[model samples]
Target: MASYYLWRSKFGGLSVPEAKRLKELETENGRLKKLLAEQVLENEVIKEALRKKW
Candidate 1:
């Protein structure tokens, strides 16, 4: 449970642009985390491939 005023103030004194930016950053962060996980999996696959080839 959250209060609107508190949320808005945290986003920057009740500014719409600030709220939007916060949401955008959150979304970007989520995407980056997902990408990182994918890259880790890819790295493991590459490592296994190298181990077999060399």
Candidate 2:
């Protein structure tokens, strides 16, 4: 119990609303990263296709 409280205080533990917002932000970040990665892969494929000789 003491250790928990100490850790919480050291990290400035989030309240309910803050925690919820943090979770939402994390989810959105993950989604955006996935989209960006897909886009990068598509771009690489296109570049490779263009670079091929006839």
Candidate 3:
């Protein structure tokens, strides 16, 4: 797909090594983002529970 290529191009230029590194970094970045989101949601739920105390 044209859109897929367009999005993939944003990672790196013509070098294969660069492209591989870019993919690795993107994968790590996504994993870290997911972890952060989970922690944020957990914090919110705990906060809500605390707010309900008499």
User: Model 2, 1-54: lDDT tens per residue?
Assistant: 999888577546788788778779989999999999999999999999989944
TM-score of each: 0.65, 0.75, 0.75
What does candidate 3's lDDT look like per residue over 1-54, in tens digits?
998889767854547787888789889999999999999999999999999973
Worst 10 residues of 1 by lDDT: 5-14
Model 1: CA > 4 A from native: 1-14
Candidate 1 shows a clash count of: 0
Per the 3 Å backbone cut-off, how many clashing residue pairs does candidate 2 have? 0
RMSD score of candidate 2 (Å): 3.7
lDDT of 1: 0.86
Kindly provide the TM-score of model 3 when superposed on the true structure, using C-alpha atoms: 0.75
TM-score of 2: 0.75
Tell me model 2's lDDT, rounded to 2 decimals.
0.86
Residue 48 lDDT in candidate 3:
93
Alpha carbon RMSD to native, model 3: 2.5
